[model samples]
Target: MSNEYLYIKVDKNSMAKNKVVYLEDIAKLYSTDTDKINILKKQVVLTIKDNKPIKCVFSILKIIEIIHSIYPDVQVINLGESDFIIQYQPKKERQILKYLKIVMVSLIIFFGSAFAIMTFNEDASVEEVFKKIYELIMGSEKEGGTILEISYSIGIPIGIIVFYNHFSKVKLSNDPTPLKVQMRVYEEELDKTLIANASREDKIIDVD
Candidate 1:
């Protein structure tokens, strides 16, 4: 079927009580992306009777699944008594840009925290603290490499690496990485917000 045919709105008053519309047909109406079209094609058709969806033939959950595959932010709102509305509010994410943002934020947090720690260390500036530590370990007289100085320099970076789990992506112990935990919490909050905001149409109807 032509892409245009998918979008042709069916008049609620004219639609037969037992009319059947394929899920593929509905998916096509909303999305022109080839990948999404292929996904929709595999779904079963939806049957409408007296304008109410005939249960057992296709569940609301299934309908939600198909819709989310295309428009993650869109919602299906039941207006009751066979009346319904498709609430479309598309959310777009640029993968490359998102990753870049995460990297930038991480770097800022890492450096900012490091600077703060250094600043609070007995009122010593970061550069002065480093120089003093080096002088104490290596001795002011002998400028050559000392075991303590080398170890201290290497250990600082190593400690940071281990704490951040930069290379391994594995936690030092059973406890989750702070970044992972934060991301998970953010995702949970976002999901809760979406669920809470999903039925705006229903809320409006009730208020009226």
Candidate 2:
């Protein structure tokens, strides 16, 4: 085994049969450049203890804790695993920053969209248009909102909320939301880019 790679078998059957499973076998599946296998040989054990079989399950946090104790630079990736691959992750601390960045981006999108709509309404003189329509309907100068203005004011937001499917949280029509579809496309592209970059970097390291 190499320090660059560690294999762990997440035995669902073993977990079901035996309430407690030692990490010894998982630890033996990898060795460092120094040919040491005892590094994590007796380090950790996963135990459901007295928990019911149906409710008891493997904990990712415990597995990660065991792995991190042995290999700080590596991360476990489940590969539809009888055995799982451990890959190099450059900066573990950066995971927190990644989540923070997502939250910031979400806030920006929410507020920025609201601001953009307001700016567009102002630029297009939407209020003036509504006022004119109100006067035409009432057959006099517009003092307050007419029936058209009231109906439109209520209808526009409702239309937007329904069209986006956010009000009911279910699609009324067959079509998926443009935003959700675009997000999926972006996620796929990002995954491809990351994989390509990782492969390129590995090749470069191999050449060196």
- Best model per TM-score: 2
lDDT of 2 by residue, 1-208 (tens): 3336555545322222344455653333543443423555555454444544332223334565666766776545433222222222222458889899989998998898779978988999988988887677767787765776678668878888777766565676777777789987986565455445545555211211
Number of backbone collisions per candidate: 0, 0
Model 1 misplaced regions, further than 4 Å? 1-41, 44-107, 123-152, 168-176, 199-208
How would you encode candidate 1's per-residue C-alpha lDDT over 1-208 as one tens digit per residue? 2322122122111212235555544332344456654665656544444533321212244555555566565444433122222222223368999999999999998999788776675485644556677778767744555565577668888888677666565556676667788998996565444434545433312211
Candidate 2 structure lDDT: 0.55
Model 1 scores a C-alpha lDDT of 0.49
Candidate 2 backbone overlaps, count: 0
Give each prediction's root-mean-square deviation over alpha carbons: 14.7, 13.9
Q: After superposition, how far is residue 177 of candidate 1 from its true place, in Å?
A: 3.8
